[model samples]
Target: MKHITFYLDFISPYAYLAFEKLPAALEGVSHSVTYQPILFAGLLKHHGQLGPAEIPGKREWTYRQVLWQAHEHGIPMQMPSAHPFNPLALLRLAIACGPNRFVCETIFRHAWRGGADAADAARVQALQQQLAPGRDPASDDVKNALKQATNDAIARGLFGVPTFAVDDKLFWGFDALSMLRAYLLGDAWFATTWDAATRPTSALVRPARG
Candidate 1:
């Protein structure tokens, strides 16, 4: 069976939205979903990109858009009061879960739906204990796994959370989920490749206007 690698960061509202809808979006499809947690800050820094909240216009738009999307999807959502919170403990807790869907969902819901602050180490530890009793998130093994998974994501050319990867092809954002489903179902459009030989030079450069 084909597998889809879902790269996620708990701090991203977009990632939370994607997590809620992805299961139904891929229903009846023969594929496995692998949830991999990575640091969103690391990806942003590596790619020299800013988070949505970093910009003025984009910040307001992002909050409004996420609320609209949650309503459209019929899922309960509340924006966490804290923006740009650290996700280290959250990611490590996911690593401790080791592909447990229940744990992933619980954490996502707690952070996004419940509007809980995930950056608090004590709160994260409590959540981890609820999901996996007596599990140590700060263990060397769990820490190493998260670090390696993050580096692997960077190596795969991923610059954002909620990215889906099937083999070598990558689809980014919640909006791309439909395109991903089409591609997975063997759509001919996905098979087509752009050829540089057919490019129009006129469109490549714009004429200067006085």
Candidate 2:
């Protein structure tokens, strides 16, 4: 069985998109998925993504084009206005939910599919109310939990969400997940004959001394 750790943020449209279809993609495969919530914008900055506005016009246009692709997958998404940079609160709530599958799945679906402004105080609280009865997403306990999760995330060298880790390999981006599934299945034949345990033949060959 392969273990997959899914690190993601609610603010990421691609991450939201991945959540909908990734489970089905892994169906019948021996796998387990764990949620690890991290700060998306901070990670992007570290990866040299100078925010959306700084993107080259051509690249930005191409990105906007991908939004249309969301519809093909039956995902509801758009560049929400006033998207907040702070995902720490949401991350905290996910972490608090821990291995509670129902809780995590519910929040993810609502935030992504329902267009919930997760960072908004009232909206986030309302979501909590719906999901957990008396549990408040805006409560002091939730706030403290989020703070602790953010601290932990930073200490772990995490930079982004929807970051999937299979074994020792870390795959970022929704597009890269295809490669991740291939790895999990021990099937490199589709793209190449290389085995995960063995490096490509070229990389393994030693140079003759001149």
Candidate 3:
């Protein structure tokens, strides 16, 4: 059996797609999954990296690819009215609701199912009322929990959203989902090719930025 921690942020379209595709991806395998909401921006800041949407050319390419992937998998998705909107409220709400996939799903759909502004205040209120009626996402506890979740992800060596952690091995991005399933299936190549891929030391260094 495989146990996985699905690290995500609602700002990531790939993460949304992964969440939708994951159940079928692991259908025949015996596994348990925990969905964790974290701030993707915190990960970016810690790693000194810019998000795909932050780069103009890459942003367009990402949207193209995400749309194609969603279509290919037959997952229902609509490009949000904006890209890279604030996801703090949604993240805290997911954590505030306790251990429920429905909360996460509702929030994901709110962002990706309709062609709407992902950060609209009215929609946010609706989500709070519908998904976690009594929970206060703005409370200090929920805010701290999100901070801890991001910190914990950093401690575990994660630098991106839609990552799957299984048995201490991290598979990153929507593209790596198949690789994760293969690992869970006990592929022999992971013992050889996988470890070998990570063992080669860097032989060259790029000059530091000013």
Candidate 4:
């Protein structure tokens, strides 16, 4: 059976949005999804990249864009009280649940839709117990598993959450879902290269400051 690897982090609203829509988007397509929880903060640090929320203008635009995308997708979304909240416990819990999709979705909703503080260890443990009774989020195995997953993601050239990998091709961002779907459907355009000479220049290039 064919499968796609979904690398995600609960701290990302975009990841939550992607989790909500991907199943339906791929309906009727014969492919399975493997959810891999990773430390998004680790990825950012490894790549020396600033998240959208770290930038002034981009932060505001990202919040607006996320809400717009959620509305368009008819999904409920509420920003958590904190941005870049610690997701160590959450990631460990997800791994404890054996990387289950339902568990992942529940946690994603708790943070993004329910506006819950996923950084709280106690709260995260409670949620994990609810989904996987008797599972220990603090277990060494679970902790190591999450770390390994993050390392594996970094090794695969993933610097963002909600990244979908089908075979060797990797698609990042929730907005890339359409392209992924088209590729899954065997679209030939994806394999064709565009002629740079025929490309038109942008009409809105900003002038350099004096």
Candidate 5:
């Protein structure tokens, strides 16, 4: 059995795409996914990295690239020009996955498939009603859980959403998801195909400080 911890926030389109495709990526594999919601903007700031929207060139290239990839992979996506960066409501729904999983999956589906903002109070509340009636958005437990999840993210070295930690391995970005897929599909399948340049060590490692 394998376990993959998926740290995600509702703010990233890449996160949405990854969540939508993860089921197929894990097909036939004995695995469990734990969703941890975090503040992506803070994560980027901590690492001295720019968010996708802040990087002019990268942001432009990303939109085109994502569209192309979506076409090729049959994944539906639309990069919201004025996308909101809040993840509070989304995190609440995620942490509510205490005894059941369908609620979490439903939220992901609304955000990823419907292109809805999972963080919005109105949007999330409506979705909650449709999927799981009696699950009030204003509930005390839900509110507390969301706050705790956000705080937990800060403690976990998480600065972004859609950050996946499989066992001791941490991976970020949609571009690296294929690497995760390869890892889960037995050693032989991914060993030869996995690219080393994208690995965590290679991606972030730099010269020592003086």
Candidate 6:
């Protein structure tokens, strides 16, 4: 069986989208998925990039597009009371709660299913009661796990959430889910075009801003 490591942060709506659709995308395929809750902010800092919601027009577009995708794919989604709020607590909570499919799903739904503040005190308490129970999300072990997971992801060259890592290949974005499934199905192109596309060298580099 193929092993796939799914890297995610609950702040990403696309990650929630990918999570909902992954099982169907892998229909008739034999594979095991491991969910790793990493800090999205850590990735952004490591990669020297801004999160989607931090960009200009892209912020609004990202929301609009994901909602459109949800409608098209029949996935239930609603805008949270906020976007790009701190996801550290949620990430640590996911780890503290065991980081399994059920844990991750419950957390994602809490953030994505209702049009309310995912980080609101009441909402977070509800999640803790239901999913984590008596587990301490702020405990040292859970906190370290999240940090280590994010470091490992950065080392793997992952710059974003909703990433699927199959062996050495990294597929980023919910839009790339189809590509990931194609790889899982043993598509010949992955052995051909996929390698060829990355085999070229850049003729020129853009000058760095002074």
Q: How many residue pairs clash per model?
A: 0, 3, 0, 0, 2, 0
- Tens digit per residue, CA lDDT, model 5, 1-210: 778878776667777677767787778778898766655665776677777767778878866776777777788766543454565566555555441346556665566555445556677777666655444545787777665665766676666667777765666777767778767766674455445545565456677556
* Worst lDDT 10-window in candidate 6: 126-135
1-210 per-residue lDDT for model 1 (tens digits): 678999998888898888889888888778988888988888888877789989999999999999999999997999876877877887888888775677788888878876667666677767877878345788998888888888899999998988999978888998888888887888887556524434566656656555
Model 1's TM-score against the true structure: 0.88
Flag the better candidate by lDDT, 3 or 5: 3
Q: How far does residue 100 in candidate 2 sit from its true spot (Å)? A: 4.1
* Candidate 3 structure quality by residue, lDDT tens digits, 1-210: 789999999999999999998988888988989999999999999988899999999999999999999999999999999988999888888888873677788989999998899889999988888875456889998899999999999999999999999987999998897898899999999988976887888999989688
**On a 0 to 100 scale, what is the lDDT of residue 133 in model 2?**
38
Provide the TM-score for each candidate, comma-separated: 0.88, 0.71, 0.96, 0.87, 0.70, 0.95
| Best of the two (2, 4) by lDDT | 4
> Which pairs of residues collide in candidate 3?
none
Question: Which lDDT value does model 6 have at 2?
Answer: 88
Runs with alpha carbons beyond 4 Å of true place in candidate 4: 133-135, 194-210
lDDT of 4 by residue, 34-110 (tens): 99999898899998778889999999999999999999999999888788788877777788777778888888887
lDDT of 6 by residue, 1-210 (tens): 889999999999999999999999889888999999999999888877788899999999999999999999999999998887878878888888889999999999999987988888788978888884456899887788889999999999999989999999999988898898888889999887987898889999988667
Which scores higher on TM-score, 1 or 5? 1
RMSD for each of the candidates: 4.4, 7.2, 1.1, 4.5, 4.9, 1.4
lDDT of 3: 0.90
Candidates 4 and 5, the one with greater lDDT: 4
Candidate 3 versus the native: TM-score? 0.96
Kindly report which residue pairs in candidate 5 clash with one another. 8-162, 43-159
TM-score of 2: 0.71
* Predicted structure with the largest TM-score when compared to the true one: 3
lDDT, residue 103, model 5: 58
- By summed lDDT, the worst window of 10 consecutive residues in model 2 runs over 78-87
Candidate 5 error regions (>4 Å): 96-101, 112-122, 132-144, 154-156, 185-210
Answer with 1 or 4, whichever has the higher lDDT.
Answer: 4
